[model samples]
Target: MALLSDGHFHSGETIAQQVGLSRTAVAGHISQLSDWGLDVFKVKGKGYRLERGFSLLNAESIKKHLGNTKRAMIDVESVLPSTNTEMKKRIANARHELADGDAIFAEIQTAGRGRHGRTWLAPIGGSLTFSMYWSFPDGYQSMAGLSLMVGLAVCEALKDFGVDDAELKWPNDIYLQGKKLAGILIEVEGQIGATAHSVIGIGLNVCVPDSQYDVGQPHSDLTSYLGHTPDRNSLAAAIIKSLWTLLPKFTQQGFGPFAPHWEALDLYADKRIVLQMGEKRFSGIDRGVDASGALLVETQDGITRFHGGEVSLRGNR
Candidate 1:
């Protein structure tokens, strides 16, 4: 594991001879690591090495946090350009081979991104950005509000880590008081019919400092907010476990299943908020997400449900 994390390439024969095993055994180990979420490059005659060197997120520690769930389902990567990007590649590759239940996690995304072409500002050794890829059901159109559920998972993880004051902004941003703490980006892959893969990407400012971003939006991290960084391994495991427990239910009940919980975490719920939908804009009290995951706003005329697409929500006060 140390050699693998060192970012150096190792040939199956070299590793096998070192460990007193056959080249086949070394190759098997590489396969197992790939199955666990580490991206390994195999050059027929050259050998195997990590796509990049990264601080390994201990699988055993993550599994301990997972409790009883099958460990084989997740793929954890220590360093990735972007979890969402990696998952897209995985989905394309999986097209040739039939498999399901795959996820990609990264300690930090070198090029993490957010909704509407916004760059996800994450610094190495400071934050967590990971993505999960899942094949949802056909009628999963009912799960439109799934991002809200994943937001709840993040909040629950924060609560478990003693950051209970964390709050949820509409759609996907998590906040503390008024500062941004985390964000979520959900992207879908596949055609209108057949199997559709949903990639859920998350960015948590775990320890990012104020200097990381320019003057505009304020950002905070668990480490700075709490005076020390929370254990990344524990947090990653908690997130995976939460997603595993909630995703299946999300498939069955749609976003409605998690609406109430989402409401409880909303920092702007029932409060005045502004909806920045392109050139048009509206300000109203947020009634939280309706049954379909649309933002429900109680305007003077009545209630308006805004489906999340090409829009941004900001707390008025």
Candidate 2:
């Protein structure tokens, strides 16, 4: 994977010798790269190459660059169906054994996830994908606006990498230059005695060069906006650090401390928008979010509050 990341062809014999494998074995592996969400090109004379360049995430590099991350452990995988699922399985089996801030980062997500049972897919190394496991002493109800807070974390992370104008689309999306840049998915599990656990998953577009990759919405990547790819490891560390600093504040003050900040970054504030709740649709002007994290929209009838729904610009379809 590392050798092919340069987007240039390398003869099969050269690849085999570099990895200490036979050319036949290398050929077999090349045939299956597509299964991992990578597109490899083969030519009559040119051995093999990726359609574009990408860098693999390194867990050690992310951890080493982090500040005050001694409490939790970080692990990176080459590919995963979903990082949130992996963390949830662990929390269910041994909540007592898991520590707060434990996280898992994936280099390639074959079946990446989104809210409302939607799929968030990206090309291999074209996005930053990871999930953090946070355990709280309070019940699930204590955290009303957790998703919005998670978006703030990603927004701050992007700002650290020199992309300063990121905004939060209501509920759980990060937008840059008026296009979707990243998203958040938070799955919370409340146990007896008011103890709770949350698997906070974040998917960020880094260098998506293909127009065929559809996320059902217009989206952009960091590379296109920044003119150069920010080191994935460095950005991962920044996000992890941002989450570490914000989680405890939200736990202590609920959503009060973050509400004003979220309102400032609200992407559709005071703009005409459509709220889609299954088949029911409500057209309204965005009134921003209330203290409890519910969206407030001024429809023709009146100001309606919604706890969960898909939000987009009016007439976007």
Task: Report the number of the highest-TM-score candidate.
Answer: 2
Taking all chains together, the TM-score of candidate 2 against the true structure is 0.91
Candidate 1, TM-score vs. the true structure?
Answer: 0.78
CA-RMSD of model 1: 8.3
Q: Give the per-residue Cα lDDT of candidate 1 at 94.
A: 50
Q: What lDDT score belongs to each candidate, Candidate 1 first?
A: 0.76, 0.84
In model 2, how large is the Cα lDDT of residue 254?
A: 84
Q: Which residue segments of model 1 deviate by more than 4 Å? A: 1-56, 95-101, 211-216
Best candidate, lDDT:
2
Worst 10 residues of 2 by lDDT: 308-317
Error of 1 at 48 (Å): 27
User: In the order shown, what is each candidate's alpha-carbon RMSD?
Assistant: 8.3, 2.3
Q: Residues 210-241, candidate 1: write the lDDT tens digits.
A: 86445258877887878876777788888877
